[model samples]
Target chain A: MLQPLRDRVLVRPSEEEKQTSGGIVLPDTARKRPQEGEVLAVGAGRVLDTGLRVPPAVKVGDTVVYSKYAAMQVSSEGEDLLLLEEDAILAVRD
Target chain B: MLQPLRDRVLVRPSEEEKQTSGGIVLPDTARKRPQEGEVLAVGAGRVLDTGLRVPPAVKVGDTVVYSKYAAMQVSSEGEDLLLLEEDAILAVRD
Candidate 1:
């Protein structure tokens, strides 16, 4: 299991997408990646200047939607994972 | 000008992309969006539990590469913008 440190989160992106409302098959060469993923790990949250820990909101195994371009790419065990802060996570999918 | 509050950032995604290292021109519907963007706005750093502000690292107008899926979508002045946290930003392009 991977554990992110200091407000970082690990996510596995979903390899699926839907067409734009324009009905145009936007090529990958023209747009950014989608923002759908499954949570893999979460850090202990950022430490405040006062030395307090801010726990993250989402937990491991949660599905979430984030900004299309809002996390760092990391490779683990030959798999592509994302490390992001809790604030980077926009919403958790139910 | 838009001001993000509390660890949020605004980004304008770059509209260009290159072929993957595999040379496969993956269609947008098959893959996620790219992670290239220009910073448009940023929020103040998160407030610590001890009444201190963390102050974000990146600033407005900085070019950054972020996770494909790590921010929220917000609209301003008829433009699509992304609101993300500082930690979501992977790297600043020098």
Candidate 2:
């Protein structure tokens, strides 16, 4: 398990046609870029200028929608993953 | 005077060839985009997830270099100004 640091999240991106939940799925054109994923790991929180930490909003196993251009690709054990800041996560799917 | 809110900074951008300071100036290609300016006003701070405020690093009248694409254009009394987040500021010139 990769441990991310400070407001970062490790995500396993969902594949095409397999991202169905709540009877809604992304279109093909939108699916070309990884936008939604399952949260695999979450960092502690963001540090403020005063040294206080702001806890992350999401937790493990959350299905989240993030900004397309905000994800940084990382590979862990032959599996492609995404690393994102807490601010990059746009919404959580119920 | 336009007052900004929530970690936003309002700046009056310097024109081409007029941004000289401390014996350094940005080149023409870089000058095409507004990258440097004098901060006119600043918001209180950024509100953290915990509702704590992170004080701004830059202050009014400071000369700063910022991310070119991060600025939002606003006009005040017919004078064009730029609004940016504190994070968009890359450096403060002496």
Candidate 3:
């Protein structure tokens, strides 16, 4: 497993579907906006200028919506994943 | 004077010129890349998950290079300014 650095998070994007595993239905308007994914792993947190670390907001197994344009596609162990900064995450599904 | 929030920086982009205020000449390839600007104001720093703040890297009057696509154009006091995250800053021209 690859560990993301800084505030970056590793995500496994959900397949294209009208409904998510968490039972959240995607509205048509949201389809063109953000993409949905499952949190595979998160960085320890961003290192502050003061050398303190801020813990990640989303943890493993959390489903998140992230900026479509900001997610970088990478393949690890033959699995396609997304790498994005915490700032790019828009919302977390309950 | 608007105080930017959380690692945001207000920059006054330099006018198109072959040479920067720091005496660094713009390379031909750099023309389409980053833009040079003067730091006007800096945010307190990004608030960490721990509620701690990270100080900004660039201070007032510092000349910097920032990503063009990440900069947001805003107008204040009848002057054009660019608002960007501290992460957008590529380098500081010492």
**Per-candidate TM-score against the hidden true structure:** 0.45, 0.45, 0.45
State the lDDT of candidate 3 residue by residue for A46-78, as single tens digits.
Answer: 877767788776789987756545567788999
Q: What is the C-alpha RMSD of each candidate to the true structure, in Å?
A: 11.8, 12.1, 11.8
Measured by lDDT, the strongest candidate is 3
Shift of residue A90 alpha carbon in model 2, Å: 0.5
Which digits, one per residue and each the tens of the lDDT, describe model 3 over residues B7-84? 778789888622343454344434467888899888667785566668998999999998755455454578767667
Candidate 3 has which clashing residue pairs, if any? Answer: none
Better of 2 and 3 by lDDT: 3
- Every candidate's fraction of true contacts kept comes to 0.17, 0.00, 0.02
Per-residue lDDT over B13-84 for candidate 1, one digit per residue giving the tens place of the 0 to 100 score: 676522232344344522354477899877667776785679888887899987645355555568666666
Would you list the rank order by lDDT, best first?
A: 3, 2, 1
Q: Which model is ahead, 1 or 2, in terms of lDDT?
A: 2
Residue A94 displacement (Å), model 2: 0.6
Which candidate comes out best when scored by DockQ?
Answer: 1
Question: What's the DockQ of model 1?
Answer: 0.10
